[model samples]
Target: MASSDTYAAHAFHHSFDKERASGAITLTDVHVQFHNDQGQVRFPVSGTQFSLGGASDRLLFIRHPSEPDWNIYTSDLSILKHPALQNDVQIQRRVQQIKNKRRFTWGVFASVVMVLVAIPLLVVLFMDSLTGPLARHVPPEWEQKLGETAFAQYQMGQDFLKQEESDQLLDPLLQPLLQQLQDERYPFQFYISSDDAVNAFALPGGIVVINSGLILKADSADELLGVVAHEISHVTEQHSVRNIMGTAGVYLTINAMLGDMSGLLAMVANAAPYLINQSYSRGFETQADEKGLALLYRAQIEPEGLVTFFEKLREQEQKQLDKVAGEDNRESIESTLQFLSTHPATEDRIDHLQEQINELPHQNTLDLSLPFTTLQERVKRFVAKEDEEPET
Candidate 1:
């Protein structure tokens, strides 16, 4: 551990009195040892705090749980180099910043509350919205590291498409999106899962998992990229991280991020499965749709792909619904079957998407012209082969 020489400092003479005392204090990365006429004492640096405008603003004001009345002061700025002090300051600064972002002025709140009262079903969206501010404060590097850890845990015991298989299908389609990339924080990654569902989900940071079934159902690169773009919007907007933070209490999430990383790790470990099963809020889904449409526009691709894709999901969902019940009884049973999917497509959502598409101006979009039929066959063949392999 790093240590410093004994430095001259002063503290309260007695734990009970206001009298001052002289002491020689030594600093270490983990502990601060003070020796005086009163004897020796050690305080763990993890709990030590420093701030300005205490007994002596000119000198560093050190406070410790062990010496509540000590009111220690040191002229030597080297004490600030202590790991505990640095970490405490950093965490406080970050927490304050995140908290500040989450707070709004009364004027703004008053105006927003008016709009919110008109929309009560979306109040749940605002309840979860608190997590977004904190999510943005998590440093990109930390976010990436945490996501990789969670993703590793999630990938275990899951059937994912082979790298080559995924690369052949996705790399070309992702080019336009990649070309329009703006954020430098996350190393955006995409993977193809071998699940038999036409769905995709985003992991915290920039990891997006697309099911092979979605790809198999898509007729062209445009359709697949549309879904991929929506999922990417979830990553870029920090929705995945927000969801994770929301699932874990905000206090726990903030504390875990700024204090004990183990709490954060354990929470994500237990919650990773739920993350996969979790659905975006209607509000969150709408935001993703709009942002994803913007992404498609910026990439110079036809934005209508999203509309078509949503319509496709809606059709398939209807077919599934028809298989279970006749059309006459479908309305009564649709609510019960809502639990069967995390991604719920609706006529309203599709119509809203179409309205959005109508607003866009014409663009000479790139035609990827991917060999969808051949690729679909390849995906089918590989999935079947993998499914037949014996587990060793």
Candidate 2:
């Protein structure tokens, strides 16, 4: 506690040269004199200080009227002895610099830690995006039900094909291939449609539909096998399931990053139709192609057949283009061109298959007992006879 008589004294020095320009000056001791409120005697003040700016030529002094001879504190007098507080200023500056440096270092360290943590988390999210669709979140039965609806479309397609009598002709060629690929754990059903469009598609529940045009256009059994292999890979991998999960995961992650994940479930729900119909991405196609080729190769089927098929399809596309007359027809024809529209264009796919062939060390030729041409003709006659027989 400070006493009532205690007072703080202060002193300051200013350059005399500036004052000399204005008028005459005198050299004198400089100090402040303090007195209590009662204006009585002075008392000891412990923390007295002085400050100065610029050059000082004169000294100033002050003392209380009552204690005219009172001695100044040694510490206080020592502070005013020098021209400036050089060493003390340096120490204060160094302390401030050290504090700023520590703050900067901590800031950088915190940034580094955030980066290290965030990078791996981002990577995990990205990798998880690739696998998210496979979680089987959609009921398996619903997927099967969707597949059944597509089968009804198949029946409509078959009815349209009855006019051509080409529908029955494709089964013999397809049956053997299906048998070759049949896995007891994951049974697949094959449907041949009368559609002249060169397309083959797979639905969620292990159902694959091939257009008669695909059969008619395929140059060899091997080429057809390539198509078969591709579709079968989609089924065996349950890529549909995987795709659903992957897309959903990505959607959720994006929403989360944006800080609005509450609507992700609804977004996914709305996207269901598009997802169900969605084809695989290019990378997914490559994966399925490569894996399917391995399966075919292991089954002692010549993978080169896949490449050969692509060549034939490309030629057929050109022929189709030549026949179409108008721009609209050209556009329509262009759309039907397998390489342009289908998963793995016949040409690009053929090239990839060739690469796979070159890479595989085991190049064994497949000996298919049934020549596709003869079998195709036989199946055609059988379908015709069966069609001519009656409708029950």
Candidate 3:
């Protein structure tokens, strides 16, 4: 214990300035004083700030009265055992208050960490099961609106067949497929993108876009309808909407679980531009493929058409990649033939679809006898018109 009334300490020049000097400190019931070679300073105890970090550090931390920025940190053994500080009522209460505050802060921080960890863990474990059920709860109108927003964003850099022409090209094929769908919820709308990429995708609201390249690649209306059926299954099976749900961040997922549709919309709107390109997980793709074949069977269309189209896509990709086998500009091939039409490059996917088809009893299927040449001609004419310069 410090025997003398004064104990040595270090004091900052001003405002916790690094220019510090040695001093002797004395404590009183109502005041504290400091003496150094240069001068002496004193301040009332009630207004001064004191902190005993813990029993282990055995240090005294103080803030000067009326000069909060001026602080003191001292580990002098005598200071730790001082009678006036160890016994003062106000000083001890303030120290206890600080200790309590630190405990509370630590408790709050640990709670935040636990919540952060628990949410994602729960999502990973249950998200696959949750999305399908949650999708059913999303109102149809909300889905349509989200799909509209996302479809609108997708149109910025793309050109598509005219509505009249798209109807002529797709209506005959799509009407039959739509008629076969039972208990359908979405008001499915179809568009034909004039681009040459062999891709087709569906959006949250029954919005489906088929690239002109896919139509040109198909040998019959069955093949075209097969692809359309698969895309429609994505909507009917709620995979398209589920893909949107999957893109939402953790907080957004919480908002969704809490039934905050508006917040979910905001997340979708922000994520819309790329939503069209978001690939379905293999699980989602398998579900769509299986459901799509069911739709084909109900429509009396050849379920073989879906399998055969998958085969065509495979042949096309292998031929393209083989041509560019040693070339670094393989990106050039991908830019035009992006077979995002199916996931996994439709790679090894053919075997799965073919196996399913093999297990099914063959049905007497309708021959679409669609006008393949006329459809291609119309697409070429429309694309040429779109490329023409306006007359000056």
Number of the top candidate by TM-score?
3
lDDT of each: 0.70, 0.53, 0.73
Write candidate 3's Cα lDDT for 82-146 as tens digits. 55655667767776675676567678888999989998889866665668876787778767887
What lDDT score is found at residue 163 in candidate 1? 68
Task: Name the 10 consecutive residues with the lowest summed lDDT in model 2.
Answer: 19-28
Cα error, candidate 2, residue 125 (Å): 9.9
- Can you give the lDDT of residue 364 in candidate 3? 83
Per-model root-mean-square deviation over C-alphas: 18.8, 14.9, 10.1
Candidate 2 lDDT (Cα, whole model)?
0.53
Per-candidate clashes come to 0, 15, 0
lDDT of 1: 0.70
Q: Across residues 191-219, which tens digit of lDDT does each residue of candidate 1 receive? A: 77777888888877788888778878887
Give the range of the ten consecutive residues with the poorest summed lDDT in model 3: 383-392
